[model samples]
Target: MTAQANYNYSYDLNNNIFYSGERQIPAYELEENEIGTCEKCQSTILSLSYHEIDDEFIVTGKCSICGNISANIYGHEWNWISEIFISHFFGQTPAQTTEDSELQIPEARKSLKNEDNGIDDLELLNSIPMNQIETIFSPTEIKAMFARAKGEKCVRQYLYNARKKYKTFEDVFGIKIDI
Candidate 1:
């Protein structure tokens, strides 16, 4: 039999299924804003979602019951993961370990807060009637919906819209990245 027939959540023909060599995350390390309950099966989550390109975490040994879904936040996606570090693990950076600090960026969800909570104007929204609440998001799940009214998002758009707040590459993003 070929590798596909033997492939599992731990290994494959060309890749490791557990994704160990690159980033060995414990089953407890859930992705950002991905805790609590499952929206689909309503089952209590046994483990956290892995934040890898095209990454999938199976609830069943064969991934039968349900799975934790995830995506890559990069131009290259899966390919980019090869070049990226397994982040938010160990609480240690090249600088120092602020693991005890609760306000740390990785420790907070939706921590990169700007004025918009999809509630462009909270006062205006509150003044409206309940039936019109659909105009506002309920924040039931994911709290995620990209600003798709326009075309695909560009890094420049995020940079420009953010203004003076969007300072040098290092300040805006706590990372020193090279292209």
Candidate 2:
């Protein structure tokens, strides 16, 4: 039997089937104002929307001011997660972190004022938005830094080459990058 004949494909566009990785998240279930910053202009004010393709949920936005665009992908499992938790997860982690710590930029070194939240100075430092980092380095270079942080085997050689040719992150960002 042909693969097409053996396999069954079903979609209910009439029922609004949008796959957020594994399941459908209807328009009503999408969250708004979950907080995102622009990649080009570093604006926190965004106009956002969510849609699903195959098995991925994509949230795309444009900056209200500069018109820069940014997007995020979510799997079906993420659909049920609370907005606050998603915000915290995306905020604290490097994967999709933003650089528009706009209000926090001037004092980026300061720990968050909220008491007993348990995020330390180092976490805060690492959490510095990528847009801010981009101010100091190109996107390709930043990718090298993140690759090094992720312990990729070949990153060391590339970063070593970068160090030989350019002022390293320590010199520009003012923090020692062990990786």
Highest TM-score model number: 2
Q: What is the C-alpha RMSD of each candidate to the true structure, in Å?
A: 19.4, 17.0
lDDT of 2 by residue, 89-140 (tens): 2122112222442111111333333223343333333544454456666556
lDDT of each: 0.26, 0.39
Which number leads on lDDT?
A: 2
Error of 2 at 57 (Å): 0.5
lDDT at residue 73 of model 2 (Cα atoms): 54
* TM-score, every prediction: 0.18, 0.27
lDDT of 1 by residue, 59-132 (tens): 11111133322122223232222111121122222222233421112212222222432211222122222232
Lowest summed lDDT over 10 consecutive residues: which window, candidate 2?
A: 82-91
CA lDDT for candidate 1:
0.26
lDDT for residue 119 in candidate 1, whole number 0-100 = 18
RMSD (CA, angstroms), candidate 1: 19.4
